[model samples]
Target: MQHKTIADTMNLTIDFNDIDDGQFADVIEKIRAERRALLKATQEKYAKSRAQKALIEQQKQRLRVQLQCLYGAVVLIMLSLGWVFSNLEGTTPSLDEPGITHRTIEMTRDHRLDGIQLSQVERYFTAKFLVGDWRFRGANVEGNGITIHIEMPQPLSLEPHYQREYIRNSLCPKGDSELWLSVEPANLTIHLYSDHPSRGQSALCAS
Candidate 1:
């Protein structure tokens, strides 16, 4: 007898009442085999999809680490540049306009004279001021001391102020003894007498 088989997309329904036992067994085995093959194919496809997802996640993690490193390097470079600029700002001087320049000439204990002499002080001031392209205009030797004038190619702004203190400290190394110092600005001149009795007396006794 012939069996009626209802075929669907993924399964077959057999009416066993009209079929022989041996044919029915054969059809059942064929269906079981098809089911096993389909299940195996489905498992392989799922495993491949899982592997692809894992590879994509790994790539994303690597990219994230690289971006973090790049950002850190950029920040470090910016900090370095800021430090360099701050240092430059401190050292660099403003040159908006020409400023006054001045210097003080004084004698230490090692270079003290018994009596203050204008000519000798003038020579000392001249020698000190006539360095590094500085033109010595002239010296005015008065009863108190001498005032030496100087000329420069450019108007002084920063260096002279610092040099004034440095020169004072260097010339008056021996703080105990009295010393005569002449302060002459680029535009004005002043005579200063030492506080020591000997030098003060000599200045007062000068004709």
Candidate 2:
């Protein structure tokens, strides 16, 4: 008859009624083998788990680095675009008013602008300073004279002498002959005429 009892590591059947001293050694050996096998399995399983955890951590770290790089690249691109747009915006105004701007006036002061440009500048100044809807017809360069032809609307609003002073002082450049503001009553057109005479004309006195 055999009896069943719990051993150290595993279940084994042995005779308890008549104890076999010879078989006891075999049972002990079997239990020792079972413990050794269990230990090896546990150690292998723990080592595999640790390796898996380390690999997962490494993967997570690499993913974090990749995300950071991508974010940095996007920010850099945005900054570059902002700088480019800012410069482009700085170059020109977004809106233009009817009259000449301060920037245009500054351009006229520069001597580099040619004669034709200066005539145009005169038209701009005329529109800005004096009242009325004055249309610039064209500018003429005669022998020593320069005439700015303009179409004025209706009976002269401002004093004719006021226009003459403006033409002599502001419109005319160096070596001017204030030929005067001549008007064609039939067409409501006016001419701001000036000339570089044989004898040089004096500049207007500063007020």
Model 2: per-residue lDDT, tens digit, 48-144? 9999999999999999999999999999999999888644432221123222345443442332222333344345445653765655544332222
Best by TM-score: 1
Estimate, for each residue in 133-190, the C-alpha lDDT of model 1 and write its tens digit: 6544444433234343344554434354444443344332133422233322111232
**Candidate 2 Cα misplacement greater than 4 A, ranges:** 1-19, 91-207
lDDT of 2 at 206: 21
Candidate 1 deviation (Cα RMSD):
18.5
Which runs of model 1 end up more than 4 angstroms from their true locations? 1-12, 91-207
State the number of backbone clashes in model 2: 0
Task: Name the TM-score of candidate 2.
Answer: 0.38
Q: Candidate 2 local accuracy as lDDT? A: 0.46
Superposed Cα deviation of residue 1, candidate 1 (Å)? 11
C-alpha TM-scores of all predictions: 0.39, 0.38
Clashes of each: 0, 0
lDDT of 2 at 34: 69
